[model samples]
Target: MACVYSMRSSLFWMMLVSLTGLAITGCATSVSTTTDKPRLAQQSVLSTLWMDRAGEYRALCHQAFNMAKLQVDRRLSYHRTLEKPLAVIVDIDETVLSNVPYFSQLIDKGEVFPRGWKVWMQMSTAQAIPGALEFLKYARFRGVEVFYISNRSINEGLTATINNLVKMDFPFADQRHLLLKSKSGNKQPRRDRVEQTHEVILLIGDNLNDFSLIFSDKPVVQRNNAVDMMSSEFGKRFIILPNPIYGDWEGALYDYQWGTSSAQKLKVRQQLYNQ
Candidate 1:
């Protein structure tokens, strides 16, 4: 009886060791698999940092606005009289508002867009882009109509956007001058709508598409070529702000392929670095 009990005890100890070994192996495999998971959020870390912390970023924004003031002054001086009222068209995101906090949150949690975008919009805590408020106010003071043309969807972001702009003391934050995206992200139609009543002297944005449909949905080569072709208009009629974070430029890398997997996007970005 004593020998049998000892043998049973030894068998129990052997089974426990086998089960522990299997558990450790499973954990190792799980960890190994997670290493290949999507790292898209990490890619924007430097961009977010630059936008949030770099004085150069602020200087660039100030430079863009300063140039805008110069151009607007030039236009007003050259065309003292016109058939329509002088107007300036500008994009909302990245042009007039700094969304650094929202982007910083994404970097912290390794998340992507539309995940916290709506929440951020609703928060209405975004600050004015450097020199943006002052520039817009100057335009207003000079009797130039300020029109905001944004791709922010009407359904999800209209109210919050208006509220945020209004709260920030931006000129012309009302519905009449603030045009939100409806049924399309292409802003050409809205621009045309504004042009009907006002002579749009200047257009400002961070994305090339914000200026024209020519840059919309195009691949990298064509987009670059288009910029070169329209080089003369830049800083004159088309005032562009710097946005190194996310933009159509990044989308062009994927050939404008929307809804691509994070892993696939990361792979494309990596390959571009090698080139």
Candidate 2:
């Protein structure tokens, strides 16, 4: 009778454990089934197109570099000062460094600017832009000084940026050559510092602020006017790289209100679109 009672108790406990396991499994399965599916499947169409035309994109980069070289030569020739030492100011992200992978990651995660940008910069896994390495090498061999002027905040990812650039074997990877933003978004002070010592013959970047910080926070019409005023300088003293991902142009359209909520921003964008 004692043995029978013990067997019955064990059976009861085993049945209770089995039932509990089954209940937990059912709940998990139901929760998973109720989860929402991803809206857009696969990579973004724009990113796919960019990847497909990468070869052409690279060729264009080479062409742009060749043009820049020619312009540099002309400027030096015009000045007739071979000993003056030519200098080129380049923007880091999206200009000389390719952050397509980072952008793709953001798209895959269904994320956008500010949050996505902070993550991308923190990752600091940006590769050199196509043909940029070759151009920098050529420029170095030709005795031209290279400087990188980026708007990335100095407080964030500063060390990571240095390490990533060094890892990529970028020319002028020295700390002195890198100029990051201080507390202010204004870059003119930094540009002025570079201009004080160097001639700054060529300005290469994917953004307008990279050329002249004056137009950094200007309105759309004013920015357009500023560009028109300096039209001759562009493609001559300035070589712009392509960056369709994000730019100040978008900021201008949104009135540069980065503090505004996404819903409010979207409403403003919708109104502009309707106009």
Candidate 3:
């Protein structure tokens, strides 16, 4: 479904307009201007997916998975992974299951997140990314253990997340394979947990933090530097699904402060874009 420009109410925009000269508030803001949508910080996120790029998005998924398949082949050819059960660590949202519906609802219905989020998950209708299921199943068929590590908290929507996964016919779709965030957002701990049993051949997600702590909780520039340092590993050991909507990339622009108002954040982003 197409998104219906779901930003906050008009009064909020007026208040933000009034704050044009106000310094950054107690709540941090992002340089990425998606806060209130002069279109989502990255307009391409919605426009590309909701418009002409639907096929391109699917093609990217297929290509990423294809690259992953080749990597798996390379690993199989190498004897190092044979010593332990092989596995791939993946993030749940956006990477495997597309959550564009919730995003669309926000734009169309003007309903904010954590409001209709649970209801959306409860519906259990998140379609799998174009090539995710096939690649995951292929990994399973080759005896690779798949671990789904997501920041979707247990207290928030874990049950429905699991149900959605199982409903979508994802392999290893059970409590054993599904992991919801409990302790921290740092997925390295969960990756370590998986590595305790199997060699994690690949770490997949739409966010940079999904792969390593280097990108976790860091500033925007630092995260980019870390990505540059590990450039060689991206396609080979870390498969990143495209998610221009929201992630650490956007969060970093706000300096990781969660309390920033949409209006304030948008102002900050606008400044960045103008620069």
Candidate 4:
């Protein structure tokens, strides 16, 4: 019965294609193709699953925040008489909140970024990452302020992002504490803004860009070289989380060329294998 139904569906699609002389979107679901968006979504399946299901992912998140807590404590003990109040600036997506589910939805639908991202943000359903809430709340209890500086658009994602954080009971979820992207994804300006009044003792994020604008727009080799140069700061002043699904690291592989075709991307990935 299943075989018969499959055959009938295939025949219907064939007839429709013949009549219209144009291929319908997603009509060849079973056929393997190097179509960019769907292929990229397929590539993300494993990373998304790891983030959503693996206990290791949770442990890594906890490990990051644990180190953050220790650093904050150490800084507080050493700098008791600082003029500016202490603050921890954190990135929002995948740092404070787990958007694994959003990526999962995109994977299921063979979609990618900036497609349903705004809609997902507006849903305000993102959950706090493991240990994020506890650590931020601890910071607040210790008289330190927490600031959210994210690349999420201020216009499209402000209200929903705040709502999501507030719903999750994140510390300092208000307008004054949250800073969204205005004209650029470079978060250095936002970090500078935070530094205007508060002593930013710690910077936490999944991406290096969250720490400094130096990591922004760099190619793969330069980015790696920058990381090596800044090795001492990784677990100390910077709390780095795990996010394998998507990042600038991936973008750097294509030399930050956003216009590359899907098939070309696949070729590049294949060429870079084991290199």
**Stretches of candidate 1 exceeding 4 Å from the true structure:** 1-38, 80-82
lDDT of 1 at 86: 96
Q: Which of candidates 1 and 4 is the stronger one according to TM-score?
A: 1
Which RMSD does model 1 reach against the true structure? 6.8
Please give the distance, in angstroms, between residue 169's alpha carbon in candidate 4 and its true position after superposition. 0.2
lDDT of 1: 0.89
Highest TM-score: which candidate? 1
Q: In model 1, what lDDT does residue 103 have?
A: 85
- lDDT by residue for model 1 (78-165), tens: 7757479999999999999999999888877767786789899988989999999999999999989999999898898888998999
Which one is best on lDDT?
Answer: 1
User: Relative to the unseen true structure, what is the C-alpha lDDT of residue 83 in candidate 3, on a scale of 0 to 100?
Assistant: 91
Evaluate residue 263 in candidate 3 and report its C-alpha lDDT on the 0 to 100 scale: 68
Each candidate's TM vs. the true structure?
A: 0.86, 0.76, 0.82, 0.85
lDDT per model, in order? 0.89, 0.75, 0.79, 0.89
Give the Å shift of residue 122 in candidate 3.
Answer: 2.3
Count of clashes, each model:
0, 0, 6, 0
lDDT per residue (tens digit) for residues 63-154 in model 4: 99999999989988877664899999999999999998889888888877867988889999999999999999999999999999998999
Question: Which wins on lDDT, candidate 1 or candidate 4?
Answer: 1
Query: For residues 26-92, what per-residue lDDT tens digits would candidate 3 score against the true structure?
Result: 3454443334543442443454355224787778888999999888888888756449889998898
Q: Which pairs, if any, clash in model 4?
A: none
